[model samples]
Target: MSDGATTRVVIIGGGFAGINAAKVLARDRRIAVTLIDRSNHHLFQPLLYQVAMAGLSPADIAVPIRGLLSRFRKVSVVQDTVTGIDLEAKQVSATGQSWSYDYLVVATGARHAYFGHDEWESNAPGLKTLSQATEIRRRVLQAFESAENEEDPEVRKELLTFAIVGGGPTGVELAGAIAELSRSTLTKDFRRIDPRRTRVVLIEAGPQILAAFSAASAVRATRDLEELGAQVWTESLVTDVSEDSITIGNDGEKLRTRTVLWAAGVHASELGSALSGELDRQGRVPVGADLSVAGHPEVFALGDLARTEDDSGAVLPGVAPVAMQAGRYVGRLIRAELAGKERRPFRYVDKGQMATIGRSKAVVETGRLRLGGFLAWAAWLLIHIYYLSSFRNRALVLVQWAWSYVTFGRGARLIVDREWRNPET
Candidate 1:
């Protein structure tokens, strides 16, 4: 490989896949890696719901990307938005600069899709980035503030009602956290209207929420949500979302609410289109078993940007573990190829999945084992804390969670951006 010359590797997107790949490549001094991302920080997206729910601050679930890779002398981090990629020229065009690489890794993640209803995003924000999470937090917390000063009962009811579209983990977790925030945390804090009377409606277009999980687990989660005083509506589709109302199903049943959060569907990053290969319906690039694009071995895609499959021919879900594993695998594969060793096909080890419903409610599935309630919640907590980017963040989150569990108090509930004017007015 280049007769022992330095090999430049450019990785786009400082997500789990890109970061992990850089970490693997850093071990080899021959490979100089440059990682680029739009954000300065590497966001722990699974806990983004916590930020939106005001349970954890943005810093708690994010770490500076530069800081993560600073210790690796061979790796350099750049914060810039990637605009285009030229596979033939082996160059990447960013905001005002371009980078040439011997090998390229594209791991730019997915964003929330509105299912052709892009205009609804102004009224209903989806949680993906830190900004989106904080925006949701502002809207959720602001709704209560607005409801407190409203004199009309109907207006107050509308303000107190929160609707979440999509019943996936994000939607389910959001519904549970909002329920707890209104019923328990803000119960005694508010005066004019009863916070405990707040309504949380989870609308799912599919027959069941968390379809990725087992049927029993989905049922348990739905029951747990219902117990938290949140309504679960299945087989319902949202036709339209307005400033203060949402029309669902063919009958156009309208729900009046100032707050609506979208967690329904997500398409791959638009960068997938910049590549040469044919993209799937979700805009994911079709990658071979080696995680390389068809006809372009030097160009690789990972995480949500690529549609990867397991040895069993089952398409792998775009999750953190899959991305992390793929990143490590790609890094090692590159190293092996450079060293003139045999390259191995990427094989993801199934690590199972878990989702937390509330404080002590959760569901976990690993191989043939299944768990729910407190034990599952404990597993979820430990696993998430362990996966946090930095030890300081983990400790901070653990302490905050412990304090919240003991006192039913959320310390990061400060609303930063204030919208004074009422939506209806």
Candidate 2:
């Protein structure tokens, strides 16, 4: 404790790292902790696409921050947006309130990055928040609705074309789910335009999709995506995006589309750059071995917001396991501090990595084991359900999966949004 009083540790961003770390820190009675984030709920971000695709609902993947700590008296949860961090004062000012802390943990996670083309954000929005996912669902369903009334084939094709930039997990999942949605869910509903003929493109600047995974697995996933009727374009760079179309490279050529969904690049949250520390090109702070920002003993960073290499010097992938392990470590380090013990440098223990391409197409990579296809898909399902916030969510997601498997259809596919009434138009 500072000045022989209670030490306060304030954590910013109530993401996986912040929430888990807060849970650990609050277990101790020696210090007081405050967890802050813009949202009142901790989101299961990996499953956000499910919500967007109508496989799940908002309440399925999120738990309110205030309700999570009903039994923990030491942990205080605050919902607010942090504008900046005052390193000198060791205080966090957000929502017109200033919170003082003896130590700080910066877990503010990432937002979608537009890669210096801020204008593109307006035309092709990215899905990083629950609101964005809901908006995308609304736009997607609205596209079908608008196409039903339009007579122009050109406009109809534009409405049918769904372009996803970046062949990463989000893009791949979206393409697959939307493919299923078109071929299965909306098949009998649309009479004018064939949702089956809907052109979904997964564009990537890299040579292959799932660049972080094994090349062979990426190849398998590519084949699976092709089977699912998604045009997987590798080495295809996007030049521009608009409401009517997107300009993407096509085998030394160019092509256009109506809708564009950005799954391309996502840097660390802006909170990383606001800190008084050396930031990497991706906006991740180069955390010390112990996960502390350089020259700032009171401040620590983890999750997507931190860039820390392992003992072999290979930087860990920005995956969920990495965040969980880092959160556990930082919590221990803070506990050591409270006990008046010297904290050791953090060492990462990589569990493994897996990505699901579609329902039955997945890839799992561990130390020496590599699994793909249905086996990998099963593994992915179990792992995701295991990590989900509550048993209720796990059960609901499992039921949804089983129902989808048998019926070859999706539930919760509704376009719920405020009706547009444009006065200017």
Candidate 3:
């Protein structure tokens, strides 16, 4: 490697995959690591919905990348937007700087895909980063505030109506939380408008929501959403989206609403284009069984940026656990190579999958075991809290959840954006 003494490793992300890779590589004194990301913080994406729902703040689910890896002297965190990658030179080009590396790990994540309708993004925003979550929180809260002052009945109804596209985990969680906020938390907050009458519709293009899960789980989740006053619309396609309305299905049915959230599809990060390879339909780079790029032994890809498969030939889902596992695998593989040991193919362990509905409502599937209701919700809570970046965040989130459960209140509902104005104003 570099100088024949230590291997210079460069990681192009600070997400779950990048952090875990650094953690593993830092233990070896022979490896020098540099982690780069556009954002300074390592975000807990699983809990991003909470921030969007006003159940938690941004700081509660995000921690500075430098702070998390401060103890590791070999790791250096850099905040920069990567522009390109040169395979021949083993260099990563960022906004205004470039770095050379002996081994490279690219874990850049995915972004929302509009399926050829890029203009819709202006009206319906997706939840991925901290700013997007806060913007959603502002929109949801502002809808209610606008409804309170609107003198026209039709306009008020439209303001109180919320439409969430996609019935996946993110969409289901968001719909449930918004329902609870409108019906339970903010019911008595508005004088002129009855927040309890708010209508939430979750639209899915598939025949059923949570299509990735079992049919039984999907049915149960649908029932739970219905019980919370959120309507679940399946087998529907959004044909058009406007500033204050959405058109759906071939029948040309239109829904009038001011707040629409997108959770539909995701394409791999644009950084994947910098590499020379055949990309999948979602723009993910194809990786070998060892998570290395084709024909490039020194380069590796992980997380949503790479299309990976298990031993059984089943493509792995792009989730946090898969990314973490792949990151550790890459680190160990690099270490083994340094030690002149035999390389082993990576193996992914399918732990389980979980999705939370509203309070005390969730579904969990782990191997042959299936759980629902309060017990599943408790398990989900514990697992998420245990996986949080730090003890401080875990404690804060626990306290917030406890307080919200007891009081039926959300404390982080403030809209800090000065440019956002109520339509009725």
* Highest lDDT scorer: 3
Task: Give the per-residue lDDT digits (tens) of candidate 3, residues 1-425.
Answer: 26679899999999989989999999999999999998899999999999999999999999999998999998889999888999998999898999999999999989988898978987998889888888899889999999999999999999999999999999999999999999899988989999989999999999999988999999999999999999999999999999999999878899999989999999998888876469999999988898989989899989999999888888899899999999999999999899998879999988999999998799999998888888999999999999994636688789889999889889998887645322111
CA shift of 98, model 1, Å: 0.7
Q: Model 3: residues >4 Å from true position, as ranges?
A: 418-425
Instruction: Please give the RMSD to the true structure for each candidate, in Å.
Output: 3.1, 3.1, 3.0
Q: Which ten residues in a row have the lowest lDDT in candidate 1?
A: 416-425
Candidate 1 per-residue lDDT, tens place, 152-257, comes to: 9999999999999999888999999999888899999888989999999999999999889999999999999999989999998999999889999889899999
How do the predictions measure up, each by TM-score?
Answer: 0.97, 0.94, 0.97
lDDT of 3 at 101: 96
lDDT of each: 0.90, 0.81, 0.91
Q: Tell me how far the alpha carbon of residue 353 in candidate 3 is from the true structure, in angstroms, after superposition.
A: 0.5
TM-score for candidate 1: 0.97
Better of 1 and 3 by lDDT: 3
